[model samples]
Target: MSSVDIPRTYGALLIGALFASILSGAVAVQSLIYQKMYPRDPRSIKLLVFLIWSLDTFHTGLIWGSLWKHFITDYGFSAEIDHIPWTLALSIVFTAVLTFSVHCFFANRIYMLSKRSWILTIPIVLLAVLRLISAAGTTVEMMILQSFSNFRHEVRWLFTLGLALSSGVDILITVSLFYLLQSSRTEGGRFNGVIDSLILYTFETGSITSAATVVSMICWIVAPTNLIFMGLHFVISKLYANSLLVTLNTRKNLRNRNRSVSGSGSPNNNQALILEARRAQGQNSATDSAFHVKSTEV
Candidate 1:
């Protein structure tokens, strides 16, 4: 990479890291709020928030790792680190973490909606095994970095497989949530609307992020530009931000609904009683004020 390419590369990575960090912070705040307000199992919501934070953390780590590999390595203009391994180790770990995180998130969603404990556990175990296999087979001290061509091809294939599985699980969860919301409407349509909207936003963001990853893989295999990889990071950040927003909004709407329901009695009786009480109070106050004023004048 030339001097010009260097600035562009670092700049893009920095922007992506910042975006993902902001999103992670938002998810953290929303998670805390949800834990306090919602009566649902706190563990599930906490796990979801943690997974999201992990995704963003891994993403930012990847960007920094790439910067170190490219700029600090001997081939680059700076060349500060002549022989750092730039271990595929961190990359491998990042992929594994992200893969497991996705699996956990989907499993939690499935468990939440269907209450099927066994449904998600098996696949999660399988995914964990796959990730471990993908990470193993390296020597303790230093592993030789493959040629860019080979590395790109291998990473693309592995990412595609992992992404496909994650997206498939997400789609299943999305469909389940849709049906769950449809079947479980509450009075006033308030809770149901919030649930449906949250689900819809999650589905849309997840689908688009997965699609972008597919496109990025294609671009990697065909053209092999750093820009496409950077774009993938940005898209992932956007997905994280949108998912955090949805979760926050869902919690807010649920809290508001609960407050409204708790404050109001049965609709008809509450309204009639409120009206009659107001009318009687108004008449008595007027009569007293007039009597007092006349007595003072006399």
Candidate 2:
């Protein structure tokens, strides 16, 4: 380790640890609020919420455990981070699972919104699956190699590839979702408000997740020996979960917007959004005998 880089490395890891804890707390609180808001959600949606919160909380603990084991238990071992701690390796698995869970959820939404277009969603799903597998592979390699330098020297390509694919999946999901919503927008109708709000919300979430992935990869590639990249990566899955939950949790807001759109006689847009609004809320009150075709035709 270069003497000149000691402070930089320490600063990165310390800041990353701090940020991860804060974001984890934020997501934990958000998850609780989501639970309160959507007490009637379907089993599948509830299970997803459980999984996201479980993994986020566990990984946050893993970060602190690794830090304590390294900085306190094994202090003076090295001036710079070259070795990968076992807890950190474990956290990688959680990160991959958390990230893939979020990806699959969005892909499912994309699949539905794209009117069940297999072509549109299958590639995105495949990329997401590949990323998870690659991320798991990275964890295994880190465990076996046990040294950050060795991991980077031998399998950095895998690390970089996983990050790239993660970003790709996020971007694809965002664009597909926005495109579907945009296609549903009528040029002169008040319904545009709902669609526009959804668009902006989707844009904000997608951009944040994708940008975090890119910055993490850039830092790792630029300074593989430094912990700066880990700081960005640590909080990334929380961001994904938060964005998804926030969108889900705000279905009431979407409903309120849709109700106003309905007064304008935009039958098509109102119908489509109502169906979506109901689905988001996990409400199936439309019944098994309704003649209205499910509005996923968007």
Candidate 3:
């Protein structure tokens, strides 16, 4: 490796390591908070959030480990020492699996949010199948190491297809989410706020993942630079952290709203009810003085 490449490689590796730590920590913290706040739905779509973060944690760790062995260890980048075939195979398989899980998670969220499964489910399933086929092809080529160069060519094609399909899925999900949010506003329901929050969280997470995948694809096209992978890793790590924070805030807000709604039914029920009704009416009035004050604060 060139002198420039050495620092770049290690720097990328360190970033991936940091990302791994952050993702892992966020998963732990979020899991505990969700468990405490919503024990009944522990196995709900939120669990998939933890699953995705866990996959990212492992993925980043694997990238970091490979970089460490290549840059820090005395072992040269021989195929055997690098475990090139095994690494390639594992990367393809695990990445496909992760993508499938993500699609499923999104589909589940859409279903829970809108009670509309068929809309998202069909496309997600199709894309997941494509990803699995691409993964299998790449893994097969890696297992037969004698055709490594040919395998790289095949893998490149698979990566390109995977990228396109994944991007399409993300775009569709984003549009669907926005549509759901718009519909929710006029069609008020019990879980409207929760649904909106989930949709926003899922859309943002998908955007981050798609962006990382784009960077990874570029690295594949140009050169196998650790910097690209590291950048993607860090992006995902930050995405997970931000997602957890958003979820926590949403949960807190929901709790506060519920409390506000419930607290008005106490011994001072008559006065509290009247006050709340006034507040509600004022909330809907364009000329309400409090509305202006709250809007200014916002």
TM-score of each: 0.59, 0.90, 0.65
Give the candidate number with the greatest lDDT.
2
lDDT digits (tens) for residues 190-277 of candidate 1: 2344455555765776566557556655654554534445435444543534454354335444445444643554534322111000
- Give Cα distance to truth, residue 94, candidate 3, Å: 2.5
RMSD of each: 14.6, 3.8, 9.9
Per-residue CA lDDT of candidate 3, range 1-298, in tens? 2322655555665675576567657666765665565444434345565666666566656655655555556346433232343543455566666666656555554554455558666776687678667766666666775233444554657656766676666666667666655554423333345445545765776677677767766765676533444345344434534444344335555545544644543453222211111121223532111101000110
lDDT order, best first, reads 2, 3, 1
Sorting all predicted structures by TM-score, with the top scorer first, yields 2, 3, 1
CA lDDT, every model vs. true structure: 0.46, 0.78, 0.52
Question: Would you give me the overall lDDT of model 3?
Answer: 0.52
Please tell me which predicted candidate would have the highest TM-score against the true structure.
2
What is the Cα-based TM-score of model 3? 0.65
Better of 2 and 3 by TM-score: 2
Instruction: Give candidate 1 misplaced runs (Cα > 4 Å).
Output: 1-18, 21-62, 72-89, 117-144, 153-156, 186-191, 225-227, 230-252, 258-298
